[model samples]
Target: MKGKIIFFSVFFLLTTGAISAQAKNAPRSIISTTALIRKYHDQKELSGMQKGELLELYIERIKVLVKTLPYIALVTKPGVTMADLGIPDDSEHKKSLENQALGTSTFLDTTVDFQRKMMPYSDKANLIAAILFYEGTLKSLHEFNELNEM
Candidate 1:
């Protein structure tokens, strides 16, 4: 009886440890951008570094998912340059996109007449984080509008 109890106890301990290790090593499921923003929004306060870290994580996931995103067809006639469509040159566009990825661009955060609303965060990191949430909300709204229009 004593030997059987010892064996069962050891077996239980080993199984529990293995289960815990597996849980610790498990990869977290990816949630939607809006859901991520909502998770952060629920927090009462987040330091600039924390916000920046979240933004970096968000950007990394976006980079990973780029290949899976829908393609935008850019059809143009012969001899038509990007400038004809008011699009900046390659270098300028690259810089602009980089700023956008960093969530520091004012152009996209403005109204039709370029009227800008002040963001809550004054620090760059916090501002970038706030912009991440703002952009996510805007993207969701645009998608919703498109579906309704269709």
Candidate 2:
């Protein structure tokens, strides 16, 4: 009985160690931009168009980011160029992340006017909450990406 118990305990310990090692070195999964907009963020207070445009801009970024994340993880240099990402040109990518901060949608002026109406109390709070959650997820993924070298 004592010998059997010893054998099982050693087996269990080895299995646990293997599992821990695999977890520590696991590849991190990044969230899709569409899910981040629809499922993750709380945009109930935002107008439908406002919500859609916000989602659209991030979706565009995500598409490019998904392709470039490996390259991004490999390099720490600022302003990752088209050559780095193996793109014909990065104008489209540059344009996507740009107009967002400026609130100018190049797709449709009617869809998104560069209007900055004051947000209501609840909307402001909710927007901040959603952004924090999204930011946290991105930060985690970025940290994991950086950890590959270490």
Maximum-lDDT candidate:
2
- What TM-score does model 2 achieve against the real structure? 0.29
Q: What overall lDDT goes with each candidate model?
A: 0.43, 0.46
Highest TM-score: give the candidate number: 2
Query: Model 2: per-residue lDDT, tens digit, 1-150?
Result: 999999999999999999999976543322222323233334453334354445444443343333334444444333444455564444565554444423433432433232223222235444445444554555565577678658
Off by over 4 Å in 1: 32-150
Quality of model 2 by C-alpha lDDT: 0.46
Clash pairs detected, candidate 1: none
